[model samples]
Target: LEAYQKFVFEEDRLRSVQIAHHICSLMQRGNVVVRWKLYHSVFNPVLQRGVKLAHHCQHSSVTSAQMHSCPHHDQCLPQEVLQVYLKTLPALLKS
Candidate 1:
C-alpha cells in the first residue's frame, strides 16, 4: 500500500510538471484561449471563494468590501492582506 501511494504521488508530481510545461509553451505562443481558460477555470474560482468567505465574516459597518479594518490593527484586514495579495499579480504570474 505504501509503495502504491508513493507511486501515485510521483505520478501526480510528474503530471503537474508536464502541465506546467505545457502551459508555459502555450504562454510563449501567446495563446489567449489557454491563458484565459487557466485563469477563469482554475484561478478565478479560487479567488472568488476566498473573497466570499472574507466578506461573510465582515461587520456590516465595515463600509468597504474586503477593506474592513481588523480589530487588532488600525488598518482594514482586507485592505492590508487580501487587497495586497490581489495586487501582487506579477508575483503570482511568476509562480
Candidate 2:
C-alpha cells in the first residue's frame, strides 16, 4: 500500500509538472502580437473555463493529491504558466 501510494503521488506530481511545462512552452512560443491575439481571442474563454474548473478541482471534495494530478479540464494552466504570463504583463500593458 505504501508503495502504491508513493507511485500515485509521483504520478500526480509529474502530471502537474507537465501541465506547468506545457503552459510555459506555449508562452515561450508566443510573441507579443500572438500573445495579444491570444489574450483577446483564446485566453478569455480559457480563463472563464479555468475558473469553473478551479471551483471543482481546487475546492471540491476530491483529494488535493488527486486534484494536483487530475487537473480539471478547464484548469489547464499551472502556476509556472502564470509566471511567464506575468513576465509579459509590462509589455502587454504598455501596448
Candidate 3:
C-alpha cells in the first residue's frame, strides 16, 4: 500500500502510469482478493481524480469540474496518475 501510494502521490505523471500499467499486469496474476485490494489502492484515488486525470487521458469535463475540491476523500495529486487504472476500478470495486 505504501509503495502504491508513493508511486501515485509522489511520482511524475509518466512514471505513475507506467507503474499503474505494470501493477495492473501483476494484479491479474494474483488471487481475487489480492487483486481487489491492490486495485482499490490504485484506482479509488484516480476515480476521485476522474475529472482531473480523465482530461489528461483526453476525457471531457468542464473547467469547474476539474477544479472542484473533494474534501471527503484525501487530497489527490494535482497531476494525472492513472488513466488506464481508472478503467479497472469500477468492476473491481463491485467485485
Top candidate (lDDT): 3
Residue-level lDDT tens digits of model 1 in 1-95: 22322222232445534443443344445566755665555335435644664564564434454333535322212232333334544644765
TM-score of candidate 3 versus the correct structure, residues matched by position: 0.55
**Residues forming the 10-long window of minimal summed lDDT in candidate 2:** 1-10
lDDT of 2 at 13: 46
For residues 1-95, what per-residue lDDT tens digits would candidate 2 score against the true structure? 22322222232545544444444355457787766555655444435544555566656665545655664533444443334444654655665
The local distance difference test score of model 3 is 0.60
All candidates in order of lDDT, best leading: 3, 2, 1
Residue 18, model 1: Cα distance from true site in angstroms = 15
Query: Candidate 2, which segments miss by more than 4 Å at Cα?
Result: 1-35, 68-95
Candidate 3 segments exceeding 4 Å error: 51-80, 89-95
Query: How does model 1 score by TM-score?
Result: 0.33
Selected candidate, larger TM-score, 2 vs 3: 3
Better of 1 and 3 by lDDT: 3
Q: Who wins the TM-score comparison?
A: 3
Using TM-score, rank the candidates from best to worst: 3, 2, 1
